[model samples]
Target chain A: MKIFGINLAGPVREEVERFLASNGLKLEKDVEYTAVAVCREEIVGTCSFAGNVVKCFAVRPDWQGAGIAAQLLTHISDILFSKGITETFIFTKPENGQLFSGLGYRSVAATPQVILLEGGTANIGRYINEMVREAGINGTEKAAIVMNCNPFTLGHRYLIETAARENEQVIVFVVEENRSCFSFTQRLNLVRQGTADLTNVIVIPGGRYIISANTFPTYFLKDRQISVYQELDALIFARYLAPAFNIRIRYVGTEPHCQVTNNYVEALQKILPSYGVKVCLVERVKSKGECISASRVRQLYEKCHWEELRDLLPPCTYDFLRNYPNPGSQANQAD
Target chain B: MDIKHPAKAGSLESNDIYVMVEPSSEEGIVLELDSIVMRQFGRHIEAAIKETVTKLGIDNIRIVAKDRGALDFTIKARVETAVKRALEE
Candidate 1:
């Protein structure tokens, strides 16, 4: 599918299409790579030098302008130098080949920048989905996700919105614990009640602490807990949903606030690519420069400064706050 | 340091294993060996250490690594982690 192209490189037409389909590349024509590239774990500025001809070298859009490809090209050049190959050649579209020229790889012609590495490079780069899913979804209909609506803020809302737009059915995961500023039934009720208007969205309980303390504790340092949870949910989701449905994407917010999570993300990026799961990092839902945070909203509600909370939450979240205590109210703890 | 400098110090880890920070002055660090493994590619490990240390902003600390069978990367990771932790502290 065109969607998640960088990650899946889905089906093509004719014999290639047949091979892709057989190989499990479920291309979505309308699906965009923008999301996939943003979720990409790690695709450093990638540059290549070759066997036949180094005709192509390009960095993903998200990674472009970071000089990532140039550096990568240089790294490979260093490798080539060790092997006694001082002169290297690159070919690509005239404009695109400038990148190679910039990196000291002379441009002989506007051709393909494909490379022939010294020892055959491994064809280990498999589409992430092919390895993960046994049966792939080729259509628009997809299943919904059930996730924790911990404190109910804008970040949570965006994840749901992203999934809802893509999937035919949406299942929201609300922590079925009462101690969540709004109780269990109340939290479920709140998420359920808030998305009630959206025909496709459904609300449900995220089982007990199965996901609690599930990921490494270091992830806790992230500004948003969901950032770390995104990877966790994606792994679980891919392992389970890929067979039943075309579970293509997992929406998560960028942890602009958490470098610790960013560090772990470095590894997740490397690992997830192996599984065909592209991790998306959505921009935070914000009022101004600051994202609407649950902690901030809860603080406002507790201080009885309810009005200021609106800037940070959707109207439904505020209305839920107005009712104040709901969800399995008597049963949960705030841990 | 405000500038990329070297550090030289002698830290002994247990007996029979001593570490030194060569050029114990500028942006370089040298690890001298006084143990048995010091001869078995110990110099290569120390060179890697200097490269890693310099990149890590270590200026004048020579570490006498009494490697009790620590892999190169492990030594790198542990030492870097220690150095990073120390610097952060």
Candidate 2:
């Protein structure tokens, strides 16, 4: 059997669809990398990926138990590996979980109908273990804070400071996904500058393994499906990430404006402790009883509300905002 | 290579190359290249495409290649595939 890449938007996609339909599976709309296993000019098996997660995997009943599925998976995995995606997740039926388990995937979470399996040379478990080992800290009380810090406002600083004060050390994982108005480098730099004085805090990139775009695409979408994204994100963090960091507490700011954030906090509150990761919601930093937020700062910048924006940001962030070029008028100097 | 029709191949994903080919009344191959590594590998990529199309023995065509750091083999393969698809009757 020969495995070849097929574009979902191309003519060959119909063959893939027919193959999937024959196996009682439907096409997953978001799939990107799709490979069809062809034998004697007939499509015998198919697999697809959405980010690092494998979806819509199917093999013809006649082709099953003959190693076609394994071949297909290996082919797709090679492609993903070449692109620097080492870790991968898959959602499959519970009965088929045993099959994947034999292929190096370990079951992380499961329900009667569906099971989530993660595997790779650098899976989350190994990655965190390595990071912790390199850190050389044992039995030190640690708290975790995952922040986007789109522009690193005072609100974020307040949350991190609170976490730092409560624990011996705070591990600050800045989300590495570049979906914000500021680039990842810019955001990371802003957070670094904003938190430079927090001697007890360790800043690190969250990589693509944490609340990444791969795991939580909807979170970065302009119109978010907040509840669904929140539940899934909270589950991944509580089940995998928090433990990896050896964090007993995850500190977040209470959301006064964004109902979506409040809902996420609620989900974290319900789920984190169940997995031994405590959720702490610190009251947000406020100016005149108004919660300080990155989005608010962006809005104020766009409106040229420098005075209010300055109030909402820390000195470092305020400086960055002041110097950030205005997209509306390219020629005008940032005031 | 000579283009008998308009066709396309490849994807815009990282480490992939997208090629769009169409019939051109112009006498020789007109190649347009856009790549993230245009400053570094741009000349090499163009040379690969030119070699592949010349080996295919078609002269009059239009080629638009959007590259995302594809390897030399990938560039050649994608260009050949696109040329063949465009030459299809």
Candidate 2 is graded, for docking, as: incorrect
Instruction: Please give the distance, in angstroms, between residue A187's alpha carbon in candidate 2 and its true position after superposition.
Output: 2.1
lDDT of 1 at B28: 47
CAPRI grade of model 1: incorrect
- Cα lDDT for residue A192, candidate 2: 85
Model 1, A1-335: lDDT tens digits are 11122332533223233332443432223222211211234332223333222322345555566545434443444344345443344323345544443333332212121211211111111112332232322444444444445556766777678778776765554554344445567556657666777777656555422232223222122324444443443444444443334444444555577664455455345444565656556676777677766666766666656567776666777777766563333223242
List-wise, what DockQ does each model earn? 0.01, 0.02
- State the lDDT of candidate 2 residue by residue for A36-145, as single tens digits: 98999999999888787777888888888876766776677667755656567886667989777655466776644456677543245545666666666665668988
Which one is best on TM-score? 2
TM-scores vs. true structure, each candidate: 0.37, 0.65
For each model in turn, which proportion of the native inter-chain contacts is also found? Answer: 0.00, 0.00
Tens digits of per-residue lDDT, candidate 2, B1-89, equal 36776666665445777676766645787776767688998899999998999999988887867676889999989998988887778
